[model samples]
Target chain A: MSIGSTIICLLGALFMTSSAFGQAMDAPTDLAGTGYFRDQDTLPGSFRFYQQLPGGESGFWGMGPSRPNLRRSSFKIDAHDDVVYYSPEVRCQKCHEPQTKDLHYLRMGITCVQCHRGQPVAGVYQYYSPLNPIRRHAYVCAKCHEGATPSFASYMVHEPNPIASEAQGRFPLLYYAVWFMLILAGGVFVIFLPYTVFWWIRDLVAKLTRRPSHGS
Target chain B: MAVDRTRLKRFPPVQRLWHLGLLVVFMILSVTGIAWMYFETPWGRGLAEQFGGFTGTLEIHRIAGLVMLAGFVLHLLYMLFKIDWKRFSQSLMGPDSLVFQWIDIKGFFAHLGWVFGLRKYPHFDRWSWWEKFDYWAVWWGLIIVGVTGLMLYNPVLTSDFMPGWLLNVALWVHRIEAVLAMGHIFTIHFTVEHWRPSAFPYNASMFDGSVDLEEARHEHPAWVERLEREGRLEGTLVPPPPVPLRILYFVFGYAIILLGLFLLVFAIANAALLTLF
Candidate 1:
């Protein structure tokens, strides 16, 4: 894409990632979504509300890649403890299904609609908000706390060696080995690839001018 | 110049057939493998659709992997049994083998010197160091990828004996190796074999099973000299490949090379855009 399109897309992405402040759901008719916290009676905001679910009742402080704190980056199938893992082993929390879905029961301190809105596309922000809540987890809160699909933020962290799923706390050796391979591959490519490409260009120029090429 | 004389049969008929089979199978594997890796992306998903779908593409990749393994095994057996046990040892050190030699080590540095204009071109042999390196790289990729793919194929079977964490390692190795292979083959391998001025557009030797006498004299001078001294040079010369086969080679070679170029450009463009958008 042109520089203008890239800049426009970047600005649009930045705008879309803007977090919607957690709103209260006092009405009985309102929905208590996945991002909804069962009011710890701490400060009334979303972070205050969501913190209760992990450090409070579920007792699992970091049940995320799904709902880990902003610092939460990666996880694996065999991970556990403070790290994330399978639903039954570590976190069996209601990822999408709320604890109590009583239409009459209203336990929404931070409604998902507040922050998880707008489904933009191709540099168009608010392209599908409300009617089709962009529901993007780019802001650490997709519509339903999606754990299956990783976001661009996750990929940015997995850079240089970009594996589909990384082995972190589960296999500490492999985790570090992955980093080692990344640096090694980077170093090898950086040194060898450009040098050869330079040779190719030089040889091509010589051939065009009817000169004998080097290394023929 | 020996261009006026007959061409040298660099590759035998069977070897040429083997190479053609590998080219087709490898091209398929590379495409299907890329689709599997990037299935999350729209372009990847779209590519997968060409093969059927995600599952279909992966199935093709698996089948191609098995084919590659079979070819590798067949080639190894041929290498081991093609000659008597006594000659096998000698052949390992001989030009007949693809084994790396001390000369290759010197050839590499000498070639680099010529590239920098510090020396004349290095002596060309039956196989260049880079050619041997490329051959071995494929073997390395196959071993790692094939083993890991099998382990992951039946995770339950694997996890029963192997630790689940080992499977994680297998997955990591399988993926990293695939990416490394694709990146290297599409760029460096292509550049060396087909993008050089001497071989610009394409090289027909792999396709037609022989090199022109003049070309062989220039590229594999040491081997040609050895043949001439041993009085085996005339025996190695043969008429050019049949026209139909040459035509097929041109069509097939250009198509694959063009596809490789397109894929390389496509990947770079998307990767950059993905980081931004």
Candidate 2:
């Protein structure tokens, strides 16, 4: 064979070997593929972050009558007790309507899954779960809100007003004033403490030696 | 035979009792209050557990606060009974009173000068400027902490008349004032009273209600001179603290001083860590 044909054959072998290795490793076709759920033997949709059975009225058996309107698009559970259908994608608005309705950041068009993407339990998204296990909402807030001026980040988003115009709010001025006083008092005490210790030591030594100290 | 040296009556017996009561109550309040404020700390958590958890700690703190308030009220009543109407009115007016005087400003500056080796020690009367400051700080702390504490103790009720934020303000004030009061009493007041070279070891005058004649002459020469002029110098003489009581003072006083020092270190460390992290 000619040198050019030999080179082409070698390139073909290399490409085939790489493709085989990739398939063996179960590498995703696209970098952003959602990946498959092994237990259910189905591909998880882009929106479905959790792996558990869908929860809510239609998700749980005997909880309520199965609503055909809320059936899943991709998968269905066919058990002896009941057959249920679930959507390919699990959206947070399906369960948490009240909390997510008038959220300040949601008004900015930020999706819930953007901040809360993980599946805490098998069918429960992190934000939808009652127990917020990884409580780092402050750090999350700081990521975007804390820009040039970090002090602005101290403003509590939940309760923005310092004076309680309603049933509940913190007095920021009072909080800061108290902190200032505490820091000032602590600073003064620290500065004076060494002098006191010195005096005490001097007095002790004078008493032991039975000699008259200058101040005494 | 050596002539028995005369001592001067400084704090009266009633005054001494009040001081002791206030000291003990203040210490208890400080411990419980600080523990509750910093409940996340190991020492605070241990104290809470020792006192039977958070609720128990708060109960003890409230009780101690109330006791301190009562003692303060009794002190006010005692002063009312002791002082004549004329003296009371005079105290309301400036000089020779515990109220800050122009002389105190001068004396404070003079003392600063003396401290810097610019002059001799300023001649102090019955109460030095710092002593008067210490006295009034207690009154200030009591009013602020007491009123705020009352508001916080019944926040639900208080919120009916006032806004809920006011209760928040009260809580902030109460905690800060408590810290300030504890810090002042444990460090500055302790230093002035017990750790001063002149007051070396401890000042027994508050405990025993008597001062050594020489100490009286040295520390409060103006007052001693005034007593002599009034022919009350001899009347002021009293026996020193009894041996057993002195021994008790020696032990308890040192222990208290050491405890205060330890607390001072802990407070500083806690503050530094909190600020840094």
Encode model 2's per-residue lDDT on A4-84: one tens digit a residue. 999999999999999888874554453221223342223334233222222112222322111223224222221111314
lDDT of model number 2: 0.59
Give the lDDT of residue B188 in candidate 2: 72
- Per-candidate local distance difference test: 0.60, 0.59
DockQ of each: 0.10, 0.08
Residue range B1-277, candidate 1, lDDT tens digits: 3344478888887788777887788889888977766565688778889999977998898888889889988988877677668767776888767888898999888877776767766777788888788888778777877888887665545544543335445666777677677778778888888879878777888777788887777777888888999999989888876779788888888898877777777767667433111
Please give each candidate's TM-score. 0.64, 0.61
Proportion of native contacts kept per candidate: 0.22, 0.19
Give me the TM-scores of chain B across the candidates.
0.92, 0.91
Q: What lDDT score goes with residue B16 in model 1?
A: 81
What is the alpha-carbon interface RMSD for each candidate? 11.4, 15.6
Q: Candidate 2 docking category?
A: incorrect
Model 1 chain A worst lDDT run, 10 consecutive residues = A150-159
Model 2 chain B weakest lDDT span, ten residues long: B268-277
